[model samples]
Target: MLNVDGLKNGIVIDHIQAGMGIKIFNYLELDKVNGSVALIMKVSSKKMEKKDIIKIENVVDINFDMLGLMDPNITVNIIEDDKIKEKIKLSLPKKVENLIKCKNPRCITSIEKYIPHKFYLVDEEKSEYRCEYCDEAYKLEF
Candidate 1:
């Protein structure tokens, strides 16, 4: 077995959707970061088919909006001196603006260039969101 050391004074994003790791990584700009960062993607998990785990050492000021877009089930673990100091459990916000561009061409967001794309949660159990203007349906997975 390989030994993966713990992070010191940073964060761990867990419970990410299997293939959305790169999207989250790009959205978070983890590649351009200067600090020590580790992205272990598609790791086997009993709870999930595959999961992505990102460890960033000595970093804060995370982007919440981009995180929400990638995976709503993501959990932020804050480590201090290589010990778990804090945990941030996030819930899917009922409404998200501007983070995602509506795919529906008929959607108001796609039609109107100025109006911010707004989506409201229609089904929390299924993680479904609908456009407020054009009634476009979107299923956002965890």
Candidate 2:
């Protein structure tokens, strides 16, 4: 069995979908962090059957909105003094900027390099987002 030590003061990103942990790890730039970080993948879970977990040995800033978009099922646990200080459940963000690109060729965002790519959640069930400027639809696939 694989064993990973618990954190004393850091964050635990739990319930990451199998195979998605590496993406999240890379996105968070865990490789560059000075603190100890552990990426455990393909752990058996009763709730999910399989999941990934990331443990950090020092507190770090995270963008929860981006995480929600990537995987709404993820949960964040803050650890302090070897105990869980707080638990944060993630959900799809109502609005996001610059994370998703507008694909419409004629959209202003496409023409203007300075324009930020903006999208609004149109369908939570479908994981659908629409470009704020062009109304172009983008469906997230995970």
Candidate 3:
């Protein structure tokens, strides 16, 4: 019976994969923001059976590309005056720069710290991304 007050004007990130809410919270640096942020983890869901939710009490620019990489199934709900203004469904980004590192030791990005880690969406249905440099493949569960 956990009850959280609704946001007056902000954004709600819903349908986060279980156990990933903390990662998203840190990635968004919500703790550094001077606003109320509510993170509810492992909540029961009809679609997912278990999921995580984040409620931000103020409008903030969110990196949709990072969100897409982390979890494409996530849904973003824009709220204003305690009502949902819009619903945005996240999808895998065509390219990600500096967000995810190439694990291949031989990759130039691995040696060159200045080079931004770049990955391209190679498989949408499987949520697979490949490093632009070494052709290293990364698969993420959606």
Candidate 4:
């Protein structure tokens, strides 16, 4: 049995899809930051069959919108004194900039280096976000 200690004060990113924990870890720059972060992968889950988990032993506000865009099913648990103080259910943001790059090569953002890669929520039910510059559609692949 793999045993990991509970966080004293930090955030727990739960309900992550299997194989996505590393993406979230890199996205948050956990490696560069000096803090205790545990990335548990391939855990059995009743709902997902298999899932990943990330426990950060430090209070830091990460980009929730990016999490939502990547995996809207993710749950954020804010811990304090080894207990959950708040539970945050992630939702896709209306607009996300620089988090996701526009893949369209002909898009202005792709041509111009200075412009930020911006996407807008086009279809909430489908979890579709379109590039603001070229209207390129992007959907989260589960």
Local accuracy by lDDT, each model: 0.80, 0.95, 0.93, 0.91
Rank by lDDT (best first): 2, 3, 4, 1
lDDT of model number 3: 0.93
Off by over 4 Å in 4: none
Better of 1 and 4 by TM-score: 4
lDDT of 1 by residue, 12-116 (tens): 988877777777777778888878888888889888989988888886688676686567778889988878898877777788888656898877677779999
Which regions of candidate 1 deviate over 4 angstroms?
44-46, 103-108
Which of 1 and 2 is the better model by TM-score?
2
lDDT of 2 by residue, 7-110 (tens): 88999999999999999999999999989999999999999999999998889999999999999999999999999999999999999999999989999999
Question: What is candidate 1's CA lDDT for residue 103?
Answer: 90
Tens digit of lDDT per residue, candidate 4, span 36-96? 9999999999999999999998788798888998888899999999899999999889999
How many collisions per candidate?
0, 0, 0, 0
The whole-model C-alpha lDDT of candidate 1 against the native structure comes to: 0.80
TM-scores of all predicted structures: 0.78, 0.97, 0.87, 0.85
